[model samples]
Target: MSTFDEKLKLFAVDLYKINAIKFGEYKTKVGLITPVYCDLRVIVSYPQLLNTLAELIIEYIKKMQTFDIVCGVPYTALPIATVVSVKNSIPMVMRRKEAKDYGTKKLIEGQFKEGDNCLIVEDVVTSGSSILETVKDLKNSGIKCSDAIVLLNREQGGEKLLSENGIKMHALLSLTQLMQFLKEANCVNESVVEKVKIYLQNTQVDPNVLIKNNRLKLSFLERLNFAKNPVTRRLLQVMCDKKTTLCVAADVTSTTDLLNLAEQTGPHICLFKTHIDIVEDFHPNFLKHLKEIAERHNFIIFEDRKFADIGNTVQLQYSKSMYQISSWANLVTAHSVMGKGILEGIQQSEGLKDRGVFLLAEASCAGSLTDQSYVDATLKLAKQYPDLITGIVCQNPLLLEEPGVIQLTPGVHLESVGDRLAQQYNSPETVVLEKGADVAVVGRAITKSADPAAEAVKYKEVLWAAYEKRIASQ
Candidate 1:
């Protein structure tokens, strides 16, 4: 074997010896239980292992065409970069998780001029957020960074996400490789290897197909690979995993009725949407119980706030208001009438990455002023920020087939055509099958039924059947 190859084998063994890769039931940051947890943070304690890892990274870096300096992600990657810099005589810079308040108060603590090409070194890559964050900081300081090197890649969506941002990811080792070494060494059983393989496949988001002209052609399982927003991704995963696309709009006026409806219909629905401001008995405990039910039922909570104010006002209304919707709601509704600033404001709130907004492009209510132009503008805005806007709430399919922006059709009813208030209703076929919408939001049809749970089951069956038919026909 080559020298680099020999070092790589030794590095893998060292990783196992140091217990950097542990075999057990561990809950990931997003609450998914995994059979193994690869924590590279422990590698810093072993100088020899750390040096070998840095050497492996340096060997890979030498193959690169060119780079000016090297930078490491905060905390875990700091020492790795330090070793690589010292051993290879490469200049190094540091990125701070939080900017120092005193001294120079620099976010990036290094002496580097602008326009220098910096290669980012990270200990582990998951969603590629850390490398992207460091890239953003470097860009703001006029430093150029187009490549990143990680000790190990979890093989989730990190590489794809980084490529989407014009950054290339180079990993010294992948999770699959580590698993192979463990399996060969008898460090983990076959079942653990299979479990990790399944986990990797579940989180892998491939970009082979474009959604431009293929929106109607892709199934939920296929579309999950393209969704950028975490909430959107989780929703698609839930729908595919649960085999339902029914969203129950709990429009009841009391928290008691809301919780009752949620518990009854949670099994058959992917989203439990609410207008929390209308709840007569709202309390902190209400939010707690609702979230607990959602967790147990494997559905997301959507608060239909319909926010349409200025940026500053909407920011406070989303997170700092009496309701604090951002604290619990995984999905929210917002009107793009006030411009993209409304999106910016919402994104600035806490836990923005975990939450998503649905733009109201068309309403099921009659005489709604959302015309074609307004819908077009709303879709245009949503396309600009795929990470923030999950989809558009509309009565009809959009003319533009934008990727990753799902369609949520509301006012769905099985029998009713229209109410006295001019609220138009469509069947599950019209929404999911005919109009190419992803979700059907049914309110009074199920909520006001004699047995909400049974009624929800009916909607769920029809909705999932329609979705299956749509994708099969494609």
Candidate 2:
């Protein structure tokens, strides 16, 4: 390998020797399940090893970038910072996790004054919460900290979190690098390697540190088109006109009953969702009547096709399908796993500006595989085509509520009862009042009720009240 690789390997080997990297089934202090646990605190026990680690950190920081002062993130990073400051002749700041009332009563202990930029140095990172909080305190003190350097990145959400928050992080080695070095050294078995890989794949943000906003950031142009998108604009209009934030999910399997259901429920709903393929006897003629009813009733049709294929195939499926979905459906749902190409295919339709897609960002199941990676992918796609991605079908309202994108939630029930399947049900109030969802999609709650229209009205009342309360609270 080259010099850089050599140093990385050396650092990994050194970390292993210190028992800083342990192989076993253990839960991190932050509750991250992993086959390997990292605690660089062990380095301070051996004087020579501690100095070696400090030198490594110093070298890594110097090679990565420059800073006006070095700030250690409390207890674990203080020793390393001391050595780096003494060796490199750099100024340093120490931040205490809690300020002592008897002492200077200062949260920060250092000679560096306000306006001096600092490079945050940490031994290892899991969620980067401490770093973020420290950065917050540093900023509060008027000191600038724009970059951070960590010895080991657990491949967790920390690096991304810091970067998103405007602070860049440079790591000497990642979990993948260290794991590979250990495997090559014959320090871990095949099972250990597999466990670590699995853990890393399923690893999500620790709930406490998961950063999110109440809504999405919409561009001025997208915001202007917010009222132009037929589906979203109509929904907002329904909220304004009818004072409701509920969308009736008419998932019946018959075209005639589907039309009847839309006509019956349209007065109270802004959108009517359907699973077109499930309709027992579907035809192009069926859509002709459906569109007429939709126009007369002032509601949009959302085809829950969940198109999961490639671009060309999905485009054909959307445009040339027997039902002629592209011509009739106002909005369509697509899985984000297929990436942007799937949506790109649907966007290639004749009415590009008029149509939009709801990317399924979250699954309403008990133990779904969807995680931060999936949510991030969905957000990336939505941000790419803000106008086209009208909204997201997600349960995490805190992060998914972008300005123009509506939050379409499913598995809603008037009562707490759920189906025999794994699908979970949330109350309309829970989803809207608390979670910030713009629209609650009710299926059996409305369709199977004694009175579907009355049920629709009930959901509209609760959801609209919750929407008003949420807005008032905000």
Candidate 3:
């Protein structure tokens, strides 16, 4: 039997053919005339193919460790999620658009605890509005949606929207990947592939169009310039559209270890997050070295201080404090738990404009206190101070109502349970993909592994599988 990776490669090639064969002149839901159409609902008819597909997805999930539950959206995704759940011996949840008054009287029917983390699975994403709605329903029922996995992302605005709203999205096959697969399989001519590329290019040419309704629009290039303002660009570089890789703590005990890991996982991640309080040894020399490495590796350094104080105190922490956090760190994590005034203090500092600040809204740990009170308060604060708050770190996927607040989730682990000597988080690829996480904060699995490079490859493979599965479904 072929290894999962080989099978996945073959499957992507087959899926590309299926998509190309199915493609024809068609009108999209948005009324755009297109030369191709992808509806993965037909894949269910081929039991063997479907089974292999499910196995591929399960393989990625198992690699991350087992999850507590797998949840699928209404209509198409339910069957796929069901197969993965059954095959992996995990429970599954379903989110209905509206409450069913007849049978269950339920909108979200599953065996989930109020704070239980769930991975939301979907077939495909176009505009991402439907998934956001699903996330809202999941949160309303008191479930934590930290990650989302899909079959295909059309390289549309969905990824950005999901990321902006604080959900990390992973795809088994992205549009680009699928197109390449089609080219390799000879299913699509170069002209058709070029058309798809043009479609994506045109879509991204204007960020304003993507968020016109929300009145929030800034092209990635524009955002890059915005990030470069003398105040902001020095510490952080917003590499990807929405996701960020953050260094968790900056204490001397783990700084070197964390920086080393960040360098190894650079291209796969976006931001390097850190908490200054954890650093035991503070020195200008260390800062200089770390900054140099960050530049060399193409990642941003985030200071995850979770700052919650008055303006003067916050200013002191950023500028003249003992740690002098503003000197080297690019992004900062703060708690909106205090309100808008606290955010204003940090945003007003010199050389801080480009420095994105992630607000703590919903957090991932087992016993986080992000209840309804916190959600309401955070949403209110988010609206009042949108400019200062670059993103919100929340476990609740529904908390992504507003734009500009980049959602960064930590507590990301591939293994559900660490070996006998270590504790496990059981975060499967399915969970991460379904919940629509922006950037997953992974440590032990990558750092503690005998081969960090291999461990990183495992994550990239699993993530790629999730992306492909989503695309095939779409």
Best by lDDT: 1
Report lDDT per candidate: 0.82, 0.76, 0.63
Candidate 3 lDDT over 299-323, as tens digits, reads: 6777878888887788777878777
In angstroms, the error of model 3 at 304 is 1.1
Q: Which digits, one per residue and each the tens of the lDDT, describe model 1 over residues 45-121?
A: 88988888887887898889677788988878889999999998889988865443235646678788889999998
Off-target runs (Cα >4 Å) in candidate 3 are 1-259, 399-404, 418-428, 464-474
Better candidate number, 2 or 3, judged by TM-score: 2
The clash count for each model shown is 0, 3, 55
What would the per-residue lDDT of candidate 2 be over residues 400-428, giving only the tens digit for each residue? 33555688888788775556788778777
Clashes of 3: 55
Span of ten consecutive residues with least summed lDDT in model 3: 213-222
Give the residue spans of candidate 1 off by over 4 A: 1-213, 351-353
